[model samples]
Target: MTIEQRYQLAKAQYESWGIDVDAALAKLKQVPISIHCWQGDDVGGFEVNKQALSGGIDVTGNYPGKATTPEELRQDIEQALKLIPGQHRINLHAIYAETNGEIVERDQLKPHHFQNWIDWAKKHQLGIDFNPTLFSHPKADDGLTLSHPDQSIRDFWIRHCQASRRIAEHIGKELGSPVLTNIWIPDGYKDTPSDRLGPRKRLKESLDTIFSEEIDSTYNLDAVESKLFGIGSEAYVVGSHEFYLGYAVQNNKLCLLDTGHYHPTEMVSNKISALLLFSDKVALHVSRPVRWDSDHVVSFDDELKEIGLEIVRNDALNNVLIGLDFFDASINRVAAWTIGTRNMIKALLYALLMPNDQLKVYQEQGDYTKRLAVLEEFKSYPFGAVWDYYCERMDVPAGLDWLDHVNKYEDDVLVKRANKS
Candidate 1:
C-alpha cells in the first residue's frame, strides 16, 4: 500500500479498537528503529546455555583472545549474523575484552583485512554497530579509570575506536550507510572508591576529544552515547552515568540505556521520560528483569512487563535500537534469536496499541472522573487482542518458548516473591 493509504488504514484500525486513531497514527509516524546485539555472547566471552536455546549456536567466546586469527573473528561474525537476521545492520561488541589481556596487532590481520571486513559487511547488507567498550576481561585494567592512571595500559581501546571510525567513515561515505559508534565502560569502584576518578574522567574526556577531533561527519548521524551504572553493589565514580550522557548530548549523541544498570529503585519508564525530555536522544538495551540480574532477553509476563511495554508504546520510540540484552551463562543461541525477534514484533504491536491518550487529558484537566473513564478504557482492551492482531498480520512461529523458559524458573521464584504476605 502507499504511505498515505497505510496511514489511513492504521487510523481506521486504531479507531475500531476504541482508541484515538488520529493520535495513535500521528505517534506512529514519528518513530524510527534499529536493533543491536545484546542477545549473543560478548564475541567469545561466555556461552549462555538454557533449555529454551536447545539447538542453537553456543553464545560463547573470548574476544581478542579467540579472535587471535582474523579468519576466526570473521567466522564468528558470520555465525552471529545468521542467528540475528536484522542484527547484521547493527553490531554490538559482544566481547570487548574477548581476547582477555592479549592484544591483536594490526599486522595480525592482512594489510587490507579491515577493508575486507567492511566489504564483507556490505556484501551481507549490514551496517556496523561499533560498541567499542572496556569490560570483557576479568583482568581488563581500567581503560576508563585507575588501570590507566599513568598510560600504564596501552592505548588499545583508543586505537580501536580510531580505526573503527575510519572504517565506518569510509563505508558510510562509499556505501551510504552510517556506522554507529558507542562507548560503555564497566570499570567502577574496585576497592573503597579510590581518589582516582581522574582516570575515568580523563578516559571519557579523551573519548569525547577523539570523537570531536577524529570522527568523520559521515559517522555523526549514527553516534551513540552509552553509560554503565553501579559497580558491585555500592561503588560508583564521580561522573559516570549522567556525566557521559551529558557530554554526548552536548555533542549531539543518542543515549544508550542498559537494562541491568539501575539502583533497584529507579524506574525505567521515568528514566526514559527524563532522557526524552532532555534530548531527542535514546537507544534501548532491551532485556528482561530477573530480580536484580539483567537477563538479556525479551521479557516474559512479569509484573513490570506491561508497564514497560506501555512506556515504549506511549512514547512511540520505534526508530531506536533494540538490543536483546540476553547475557545468561547458558542460553540456547537459536532460542535466544527466535524469542528476541518474536518478542520485538510483539512489543512493537503493544506499543502501537497502548497509548494513554486520554490519560494526558485527564491529568491536564485534573478531572478525577475523566481519569477514571480513561482507566476503564484501558482495562477494556481485548484480552490478548494485541497478540492476536499481531499473529494475524505477521507469520508467527509456534510454541510460547519464552513462557516455557520463564515458567521453569520465573514461576517458583517470581511468584513466591510476589506472594510474600
Candidate 2:
C-alpha cells in the first residue's frame, strides 16, 4: 500500500485509543537528538599529536574508511543526517579541535581552535554540544584526571573543562541555542581503592573550580556524567552516580546518565522520573550496553521505549536534553549513527502514539489488568506505518531504504579515504 494510505489507517487505530498521532509527530520533531561526532571516526578526534584512547572504554574492530580529517567527519555526518528524519544537534569533544598542524594542549584550547566547526555548524543550521575529553590524554594516562592525587594534574583537567565551557558558550552564541557541555572523566582504580572519599572530594573541588565562572545558561549548560566502572577502573569509579547526583543537585548542574554507565539490573530509564522530580533539567547519553558498559549501538528495545515514554508521558520533552553515546566499529560508521539515531527517534514516536493517559488512569484506579492489556495491544498495533509516513514526509528514506543510501555513500566517499590512507 502507499505510505499515505498506511498512515491514515494507522492514525485511525491510534485515534480509537484517544491518541493523537499527528500531535505526537509534532512533539517528536521538536525534540532534538544530539548526534555524537566521535562515531564518525570511532572517537579518533583530529588532534595534532594524537594520544591513544585511555579510558576504561574501548572501540573494538578495525573498520576501514574511518574519517581521518575534520572535513571528512563532517561530510560523513552530513550523509547520515540526510537519511535520518528531523532536525538534530551535533555533539563534539575537546579532542576534535583543529590546531592547524600545531600541538595545542587541552588546557590551552580556545574558541578560535574550533572556529571551523562553528562556521560549519552555522552553515548546516545545526546546534553544537560540547564535551571535555577527560580520557585519552597524557595527564589521564594513569587513569586519573579530576580526582588525581597530584594537585597539578587535577588543576590541568579543571582548566580543560573550563576552556570547554567557554568554547561551548561560543558555539551556543553562534548557533543561537543553548549548548550542553558535558564532563565525563575516567578516574578509577583497577583494584579496590584504599580511599574512595579522597578522590571524590578532589573531584568535587575540581568541578567547583571549573564551574567557578558564571556563564549564562542561554549560552552553555554544564553537565557531569557518572560511571559505574571501566576497563581499568573496575573496582571503583570516583565520580559515581551518587556523587554526581548529589553534586548536581547541590550546585544546580545537570547530571548526565549514560545508559551503559549503570549496572546490568539498574536501568537508566527508571531514574528519569526520579531526577525530573527534583531537577529542572536532566541530560542523557542514550546507549545500549550488553554484558558490560560496552558502547554498543542503541537498539529499539524495551528500555529505549520506556525511556521515550518517561520523557513524553511526564511532559519533560523540553526539560530533558536527549543525546546519543555509542561507538561500534563492527559496521559502517555512518550507518552506525543512522541506525542508532533512527532507533532513538523511533522509540520516541512509539511512546508518543501510546494511550498514556488511559494507562495512568488504570494504574491510579487499581486496574493493572487493563493497563497490561492495552499496553500489549498497542505493541501489535500499526506503529510501523506511522513511522514510515513520518520518514517519507520528512523527505528521508523509509524502512530499510536508508541503508542503501549509507552503502552508496560508503562506496562513493568513505572507501576513497581508506584507499588514500
Candidate 3:
C-alpha cells in the first residue's frame, strides 16, 4: 500500500485506542532537537591551538573526510539536515569560533567571532545553542578548570564561561530565540583527591562569578552538566551529579543530563521525573556509550526509547531541551549525524505514539497486568510505517532512501576533501 494509505490505516487503528496519530505527528514536528556541531569534526574545533583533546574527552578513529574548517562543517551539517526530518537547532562550542586568522583568547571572545555562524543559522532559519569549551587549553592541562586551586586559572575559566553566556545572549537576541548556554567542565583527579570539598567550593565560587551578570531569560538560559568520570578522572570528579543537581536547584538554573555521563546500569530516564519537580527546565546531551563514557553515535535502542517515554509521559517536552552529543569518526561524519539524529526523532515519535494516558490510567487503577500487556503489545506496532510517513511529510527521504543522499554527498563532497589532503 502507499504511504498515505498505510498512515490512514494506522490512524484508524490508533483512534480505536483513543490515541490521536495526527496529534502525535504534529507534536513531534514541533519538537526541535539540537544537533551538536562537533560530530562533523570528531570534536576537533577551529581553535588556533591544535592541542590534543584533553580533560577526559577523546574521539577515537582516524576517519577520513572530517570537516576541518568552519565552512566545511557547516556544509556537512547542511547535508545531514536534508535527510533528517523536523525543524532542529545547531549546538556550538566556543572552540568553533571563526577568528579569521586572529588569536582570540577564550575569555576575550565576543559575538563577532560567531557572526558568520549567526548569519549562517539565520539563512537556514535555525536557532543556535552555545557551550563553553573548558578543555584542551593550557590552563586546563592539569585536568582542572573552574575548580582549580590557583586563583588566576580559576578566574580565567570563569571569565571564559561568562563570555560564553554573553555570546549566547547575542545569538539569541539576533535570532529571536533563547540560546541554551551549557557549561560542562572536565575537572577531576586521576587518583582520589585529598580534599573533594575544596574543589567543589572553588567551583561554586567560580560559577557564582560567571553567573553574576544576569541576562534576560528570553535571550539566554544556563545549564550545568556533570560526568561520572573521565580518562584521567577515574577516581574522583568534582562536578559530580549530586553537586550540579544541588547547584541547579539552589540557583534555579537548568541541569543538563548527558546520557553517557553516568554508570552503565544507571539510566537517565529514571532521573527525569525527579529533576522536573524542582528545576523549571532541564537540558540533555543525548549520546550512546558502549561500556564507559565513550561518545558513540546514538541508536534507536531501549534506553533511548525510555528517555523519550519519560519526557512524553511526564508532559515535559516544553521543559526539556533535547540535544545530540556524540562523535564517531569511523564512518562518514554526515551519515553519522543523519543516523543519530533520525534515531532520536524515531525514539520521540514512538513515545508520542504510545498510549501514555491509558497506561497511566491502568497503573492508577492498580491493573499491573493490563499495563504490562499494553506496553508489550505496543512493541509490535507498525512504528516503522508511521516513521516513514513522518519523513515523507517532513520532505525528507524515507527509510533506506536517505542513505543514497548521504552516499552521493560522500562521493561529491567528502571524497574531494580526502583527495586534496
List model 3 lDDT by residue over 71-145, tens digit each. Answer: 999999999999999889999999999898888899999999999999999999899999999998899999999
State the RMSD for candidate 1: 9.7
TM-score of 3: 0.99
lDDT of candidate 2 over 213-274, digit per residue (tens): 98989999999999999899999999999999999999999999999999999989899999
Q: What is the TM-score of each candidate against the true structure?
A: 0.67, 0.99, 0.99
Alpha-carbon error at 11 in model 1, in Å? 11
In Å, residue 57's CA in model 1 sits off its true spot by: 20
Question: Considering summed lDDT, which 10 consecutive residues are worst modelled in model 1?
Answer: 48-57
Please count the clashing residue pairs in each candidate, in the order shown.
26, 1, 0
Mark the 10 consecutive residues where model 3 has the least summed lDDT: 47-56
Model 1 spans > 4 angstroms off: 1-14, 17-38, 45-88, 94-103, 106-127, 137-139, 142-147, 152-154, 171-175, 220-234, 291-293, 300-319, 368-380, 383-392, 396-421
The digit string of per-residue lDDT tens for model 1 on 177-262 reads 66555655555554566465565566665566457555566654434433343434134543456765776677777777656555
